[model samples]
Target: MAGGNFMHRVLSYVINEVVVNGLANSPAFQRFAVRTSKTLEDISVKASKKRQELAEQIKEASRNFDSFKN
Candidate 1:
C-alpha cells in the first residue's frame, strides 16, 4: 500500500512537471491560445445577439400573457 502511494506521488509529480514545461516550451500552446482567444471573441458577439433576441421574445410573451389575463 505504501509503495502504491509513493508511485502515485511520483507519477503525479512527473506529469505536472511535463505539463508545466510543455506549456512553457511549446509553439502549439501559443497557436492554441491565439485561436482560442479569437473563438471566444466570436462566441461573445453571438451570445450578445442571442441574449437580445431572447429578451425580446420574453417581453413579447409577457405582453401576450398580460393581454389574455385582462
Candidate 2:
C-alpha cells in the first residue's frame, strides 16, 4: 500500500508539471493573462477615483453641517 501511494503521488506530480508547463507556454493563455491584468488595473483605477470623490463629498457635507450649527 505504501508503494502504491508513492506511485500515485509521483504520477500526480508529473501530470501537474506537464499541465503547468503546457499552459505557461501557450500563447492563448499569455494573451488571456495580459487582458485580465489590464482589466483589473483599469478597475482599480476607477475604484480609486470613486473613493476619492466620495471622500471629497463627505468633507464638503461635514463643513456644511458645521456652518449650520454655528
- Span of ten consecutive residues with least summed lDDT in model 1: 24-33
After superposing candidate 2, which stretches have Cα over 4 Å from the reference? none
List model 1 lDDT by residue over 1-70, tens digit each. Answer: 9999999999999999999999978999989989999999999999999999999999999999999999
Which parts of model 1 are misplaced by more than 4 Å? 64-70
- Candidate 2 global lDDT: 0.99
Q: State model 1's lDDT.
A: 0.98
Q: How close is candidate 1 to the true structure, as a TM-score?
A: 0.68
* Pairs of residues at least 3 apart in sequence or in different chains that clash in candidate 2: none
lDDT of each: 0.98, 0.99
Cα TM-score per model = 0.68, 0.85
Instruction: Report lDDT (Cα) of residue 53, candidate 2.
Output: 100
